[model samples]
Target chain A: MAELVTPAERRRLFTLLSPAYLWLLVAVFLPLSAMLFFSFLTDMPQDAPDWGVTLGNYAEFLTNPTYSTLLAKSLKLAVTVTFFCVLIGYPCALVLAKSIKGRSREALFLMVILPFWSNSLVRIFSWAIVLRGNGVLERAINFVLPFDVRLNLMFTTDAVVIGLVHSYLPYVILTLYLALQAVDDDLIDAARSMGASKLTILRRILLPLSLPGLLAGAVLVFVPVVGSFMEPRILGGRMGTYYGTVIEDQFVAVYNWPLGAALSFILLAVVIVILAAASPVLKRAQT
Target chain B: MSRVDVANVTKKFGQAVALDDVSITFEDGGFFALLGPSGSGKTTLLRTIAGFYFPEAGTIRIGEQNVETVPVEKRDIGMMFQNYALFPNMSVADNVGFGLRVRKTPAAEEKRRIAEALELVQLGAMANRKPSQLSGGQRQRVALARAIVTNPRVLLLDEPLSALDKTLRVDMQIELKRIQREIGITTIFVTHDQEEALTLSDRIGILKAGRIVQAGPPREVYDRPIDAFAAGFLGEANWLPEAALSGLSLPGSPGGRRFATRPEMLSISAEAPGEGRNAVKGRLQQRVFAGAMATCLVDVAGQQWKLVARDRDIPELPGGGEVWLSWDPADTLAVPA
Candidate 1:
């Protein structure tokens, strides 16, 4: 196989790949490398001539409980959002992939992924309008109940969860739908013919078979939700101060580039550990 | 073992009728094959009997109980699909034990039954392997083992051996028959392969366009097809032209009736056959050699007639010349034109 490629062909292959790798170096790795360098500095080298290299940012994170608390809160929020997405998205995916057929399935699948077409901020703001005090949701519920009710859902953790779930639900549905669609309908028929009930079929066949996709979807949702800031800020108001928002504040509000880079680097480390833990299942899903 | 009686079953898909008031009975502990071309309702009939589809109007009885409305899981039937459909996530033992576990069979009994089923299919050593780790034939055996482990009242096979290679299919056919006989279970299988149907089934039901064209023992149906469709679908048929039937005495009035003879029953020769044999004169078009058997294509009165004979039985003949195709009068089949 190695002898199959001539010298000119090898050069052409390298030439084709160099542009993308060069772009990655300039756009992604270069910025990440600069951030990593800044994370260990005592001050920004741009403005301070007396700036010295230090592990102060890292030491601060270990010494202060507030950063850890906010990180833990962000992690909890990620878990909550992912759990709801799976709970709601899996059945929707199942119906789209299996129960519905022909043109309607295509139309419904388009609807499932339609959220991705709109801007994330627009979707988050739309949820804010729906879930606010005396919003559309409360008004509709009050009208149906034949009694007036005051339901204020805005500026809370629940609002943040709702907005984030709305924004990321499509990821879960798309991955799960692909996985469920790959499962042969004949397996279901075979199981049923063997005297297996619906729940047993789900537990023994469908769930185990689609576990890789489910985990893949969960990881997709969890990783993004942990680093989320916009949804919580727009919907949670004063209550929305997660680790991500603090990282945002450091760069934009406090002008503390070193601390923000350090925090960002720590978050990257956490995400890497998670991906490593999930590599086995994700690798199985690939094959 | 139970006898399955499907009476006046009618299934429709939108405006299209998949099963047009079909009715057939599968005798207890007997092997039956539903044979048909694609879109001929053979599979629809099998799925309907398996409780996957409920006919608009029908009475399906299994062991004296009406079960047309019963859902598939409660029907107590075992089905093997064409592609095997073994759970890839499960080990062979787990795949075989699924039915028993579903029924909440005791742990000891489930293990013993899984072992027994695997042993019956000659896949005992494959118990620990995942389905992906097994070969095609081994996976097929695992599927068979999984299907029969629960000892369901009836076994339904939806072209189960069609995915296998030719030689493997023949071997599986014999193995399947042996297992069915050993268990004394009523089995109904669907296949478009007439040879497989004839080789395995005690009874064969030929379906055409949502109707049962003929249903009888393999030999009976093969020898006496009810119509042109059944006659042509089941095996190769050499139609007897009007000129060829000059003195042939056919059953009933000959008008509006066509007669055909099986390829194997017809003999080819350079000279005319002796007395009591019906013979046709035709120009030899082509002789196709296929190892032990050979096919002679004869153009008789501008109509093609095929005669299958042993390779060595065919005598040396000049290329592209006249020949006599002869058959016994009893071998002639008469059907509606």
Candidate 2:
């Protein structure tokens, strides 16, 4: 039997949770509030003397084609990376969870996740070195083939995609592996005994069953990739003028802190909408 | 309907043998049960027949075709799992209609067959409900409907009723037998429950350590089991005392073989020296009374003999006091030691 939760018990719970919630309040809510306030202003208070609350920061985004174009490009980039991650990572996760057995599965699973544990910046840099023109990747290809070929992928949109895919693939694999593992083996056997073809089993049973986890992993990759700046800065080089880098330019280079705050708030709004849309699917996958 | 023949089937998992050179047949439209203790390979044989497993050595003939190397999907069989294995995402009608859909049955025909199958199982009203919304017995009916909707040659049931409570299990048992008889599909059931096997199957094959111990009708196997394991496994038994054989053995009893009698066959007597009946004197160890029937535990010489009779027929005997037990010579059964 449990004791009734009285006002004193409620106070105790609040005390226990206050430290973590208070940290979130100071670290997340306060900064978001400050950004909202700044987005409404004409200029940063620290630099301009004649600063006043204005809608010009948002109006600039509406009028300027460059910011909206780059935002569309960033959204497209996030979609491409999420597609590849789910495509390649889902099969890898299926093999890890179902085909592999015992000790080697553990070792292989750890190897798949080993990349995310390392510095993401370092991994992106490594991709830059391997994919650059006349680099190790080209040299290896030349050694294998009889003809010389230029594999100049660095500083291109392709380079940014490659780098981002490498960084986010492992996390999605982990999510999908947990989902595929939960699918009962007997269900597969039952399907087989019913004369369902392999493709039919995967389509009718496996896909429907594991959709929630797959969607969850897709969301995880998409949200981060949309706001990604450092990867594009390093890998995209001259080609990497995404919405994130533009937002960065406002804060660091252009000194338009008010505009950056408004753009950041818009990105947050998009992320919330995406999560709200996928919540129904995620909830269905659980049962 | 097809008469399935499994000839000399052997299966192994690593070095451990799960089935060893086993052979059994199912008469077309006959209900058969594979009964055994756990780890006795009854379920393994059922799975092999269902084509979930391929034997290392054997020829499995379903009617006229050899299905030893054939894949499961092409084998054309319907199986009900221990948990019923109904697709939770689909409604009852859809779940039952899944196999028909896979076979590309037309919409109208599929609907008619699905409706007929559900009607056969008496679940026509619950066709739109999900399996989760149904009770245990209802889910069982749904599984049966799904398995039979395709009209597979044989139906394989893996402990389908073990999930239900006692009263429900008995009710489902009758329902299952009636449905099987009505459909006339060759059915093979797997269970470790001996009484369930006896009550349900027209014939039973008792397995032990991957081999068949006995195969016969329920009454034949229960009354005249070829060995001690068969006799003991099917039901209870009390071995006739060898030391007091000449004294207690009637003149007309079968000679030169070990004898045993069922607990229920023996009767309790207050007086000794019966003329034509087999009789023995023993001390009353305990009396277990349940309604009109009661069982008395008696110690004769060094062995304990059990006698079950009517509560009124069992005389009031003090514990550790002598009591006479009797049975006819014809009731004495010979069994291997």
Candidate 3:
């Protein structure tokens, strides 16, 4: 057997832990440092190192009502999309957990995941192809019914919301179904034997037990909804102007990088505070 | 106020028949046991009575109502599961109050009943705690409390004590019997343990292959088994070839296939000279001195049979020495093979 090492020999063991240490520093800390530095540095007339700090970018975002309104609008849209996702996902997950059996359930689960396998841009474009003005959806409606109603649904706030919800619903359903599956069948039977109605059992037992996954799915669906860009870019041709559009303009079109970074920081802080406040309620919902 | 009657009930799961056509009557307020090995349909029968499964054929009547069409929640039955399925999230008070709440009882009455039920199971002090914080036996007590809180007409127990250790199981058995007698609820207990069934039941229904083999009082069923399977399953019995007991003209052996003898009924003597006592010549093959009795295995007429006798009544005999074995006419039970 080998002898145990002293402090001096143990110094050699620290070398084995370096790969993960170096990876975290390079991947996370370095990029974050560049973002912070860029936010502070000024692009001056002579392109010199001004090294001067200013609150101009922060003031511009805070005082300008358009940016603030866009932020509020983004929050509202994210909430609406998240609410619909939960409403639709819960029943879908419940049915998946309770009713389906064997290969049929597997096939159904795979079908729910199929949309996510294609590229996001292509999928969004497919919806645009159908819902665009005088497109297949409008044509089919006109062909079947006598009413002359033309739908130009491609680039609007409603379109963007629909796209976001469609993109994120599979995740919500999958997470909720996994949680619902963990509930004990014996609990349901016990409740039934206690003279509880089916509705009462669902309200008192099934819904409460599956709440953790519901909250987790809501968070997963909501956080990205507030920060989404592609859906708004593709579908919100003019009518939709979420906070992501402004963030994208600052970083991509306007080249005013500091303002965009400040807006991003504000969004991050708001999301953290809101989710933390919701954690207690979500935790209580489960079990 | 009336007994439960199950008449020619059969349940089929696809091609596998879970229960054959079986009929049995449970006396009003009677403590009956459905005893069998696994997959023998004891649990299924209990569940059917609880209205969990509808029989494919036949009628089940509780009191005077035909419960075949009644749903589980409307069946007016209380049930305890094998796993003691207490609601893990709710406090003991809430769990016990659930049935009363469902029946729309007044809050004051519900609270009083919950307290009384908890005290019945000796869990009055732990009403504020969750089931996850309790021990297996304590959780079981809570389950029992929850089931009895509503004063249901019939109580169903599905192997309720199978999860406990030996000491706890015995203690719970006594407690459960006391509770049943005090409440006087028509109770149907399901278990695979023959001793447990015998110890707790007023009448036992022994089942095999989804059919009832014998249904009677514990003593009668054990003393007068109808077949070989019944005699062997109820307890330990020594089986002898039909010819061995036929030669001696045992009372029940006119057309009987075999004779079954309990170990305690066989007796040993000092020597091998006997004829009027229906003695067989044999040598002592082995002897075991149990605390209260000594069990001896003797080879009689080239066949081995076990005999038990009180330590004081044990005859002085040497191992490998020839001896005479005899038993009374009433002790031998004859059964078809």
Candidate 4:
């Protein structure tokens, strides 16, 4: 349907596109290119006089079982956190988008996204205060209950998941809310008129229609959680050693830039593969 | 297969009365239309019967079952929305078979019934296609197929044909009537277009301000509207001025009564009509020439009266000249002002 562009029009189009392309080049491609190049080196050139470019960092990843084990562990943690976020977020989104109306919906939506206003570290530390042993959650439970109980929840995998879910819950809720809001209420009514029960309508009508947004939210939560190091480090304590933390150590503590870059590239490859597997369903959802 | 009756139904949203003690019976296998303007509660009545909204005080019966407290899914009703809400994820066949599948019909029976419904709508070949791939009229046929496949006791249509183009709307109106006859399910449809109601319905109920003003056979309601609102809403009514009714033996007590005649009933002539006919002298203001028909606007005693007649039947007249509008006394409709 597009007509052939004149040369002057092509020049204008190029002028319009240059700024965004230039920003992508400077901000994304350049850094990725540097990392790819550094991933093949044996050592940093400035740190060692006998510096050479080699495949030693990638070879070390293949030889060391510890790297693969930690990578698996990080992927498991990502799946767990994404699962909980979806489990808690989808119903909240449905209630907010469909059941509530007018000004109250707006107010509730504001409350849902209110966590994004504060810094991530501040939110994570707040969770630490509530989830710590003998903290606010424990004190509240004790005051309400007849017997006392020890709640030693600090510096654990559950603590890390709680902090991460608190930080990333809004992303799922926001995406699912937009998708659920876009669904026509009349469609649900039509299904009901056909004698479809509530469960049948949810299974046959709502879920398939909103699959795109659900996948988008899951990917948004999954990618960051896979590469997360700060939350696990702050709340996971001795159990905080993941592939991301090990990659962080190579850059900051160990000063092994080549190994860190190689590990980061591997994580990127895994994420890309997961996305590639889900792209077919996402493409079908568009129609 | 069933007659639907609403008895003293009153539905309110907050303080606004949507349906005020409305009662109407949709007879078995009858095609009924609820005709009204926007905000006139025609759709509200349709939805109330569909069990989408329960009335605050009423008893609704479908066949022998009391259904005022029933949910839409349990009411055994088929409702086609204004927008033809076919599921985007399902094929035409699946959309048609949704209710059957919900009822846990056997797979072979479901397939047979889906094919049968599609065939009824003449969309048998489009079974595998998605609703989005079909054209507007095709999608309408698919919605019809889906609604009827379940063999629901009642069919509720909310302006289903309003979305189609003029030619297609006429074609689908005939198709809808034929399908409804073949199935013989009680149907209640809501529409604002008076012509569509007259063309498609066996009986018409005219609503104004959530009350049924007039309901009867199409010709009866068209010929004898109970009030001015019903008369005006159902068709164009040309008021016969009080001065013009001076010497005529008007129907009913002429005290608080006003008379009106249908546009097509009045004949325009240069001279007064013969005996037993009512005639009024008026100045011809404008004549609009449409194909096959024409409209003459006449000023009768400081009021504009419209007369519609066949273009060939109307004679050429001098511009702004005197004309007489005449009609039989039987054509005079009396309504309280």
lDDT per residue for candidate 3 within B229-310, as digits (tens), equals: 8898887677765446545747553563777688788788866535545555678999899899899998866778788889
Root-mean-square deviation (CA) per prediction? 1.9, 3.1, 4.3, 1.7
Across B1-337, the per-residue lDDT of candidate 2 in tens digits comes to 7989999999999998999999988889989999999989999999999888889999898989999888878888888888878887779998999899999999999999999999999999999998889999999999999888899988999999999999999999999999999989999999988889988999999999999999988999998888878887888788777776776654345466677888888887678856888887788989999999998999888888888888997777787777788888777778756
Residue range B1-337, candidate 4, lDDT tens digits: 7999999999999999989999999999999999999998999999989888999998999999999999999999998989999999999999999999999999999999999999999999999999999999999999998898989999999999999999999999999999999999999999999999999999999998888988999999988888899889999999877777787757877789889999999999998889998888999999999999999999999998999999998889886999988888889998888
Give per-model TM-scores.
0.96, 0.91, 0.88, 0.97
Predicted candidate 2 versus true structure: per-residue lDDT over A1-287, tens digit per residue: 56747999878988999999999999999998999999999988888899999988888888998888888899999999999999999899989987899999999988898897889778888888899988889999999999879978999999999899989998799989998998888778888887899898888888888888898899889998998998899999999989999899989999889999999888888779878887886787766
Tens digits of per-residue lDDT for model 1 on A1-287? 46645889988888999999999999999999999999999889887989999999988889999999999999999999999999999999889887999999989988988999999888888998899988999988998998888778899999999999888999999999999999999999998998888888888888888888899899999998998999888998999999999999989999999999999999889989978987987887654
DockQ of candidate 3 relative to the true structure: 0.60
Considering only the true interface residues, what is the Cα RMSD of candidate 2 after superposition? 1.2
Candidate DockQ values, in order, are 0.79, 0.65, 0.60, 0.84
Per-residue lDDT of A227 in model 4? 94
- Chain B TM (all candidates): 0.98, 0.94, 0.91, 0.98
Q: Measured with DockQ on alpha carbons, how good is candidate 2? A: 0.65
User: How much lDDT does candidate 4 score?
Assistant: 0.92
**lDDT tens readout by residue for model 1, B152-247:** 889999999999999998999999999999999999999999999999999999999999999999999999999999999999898888776777
lDDT of 4 by residue, A170-272 (tens): 9999999999998999999999999999899989998888888898999999999999999999889999899999999999999999999999999999999
Give fnat for candidate 4.
0.85
Q: Model 2: how far is B135 from its true place, Å?
A: 0.9
Give the B-chain TM-score of model 4: 0.98
| Candidate 3, CAPRI quality class derived from DockQ | medium
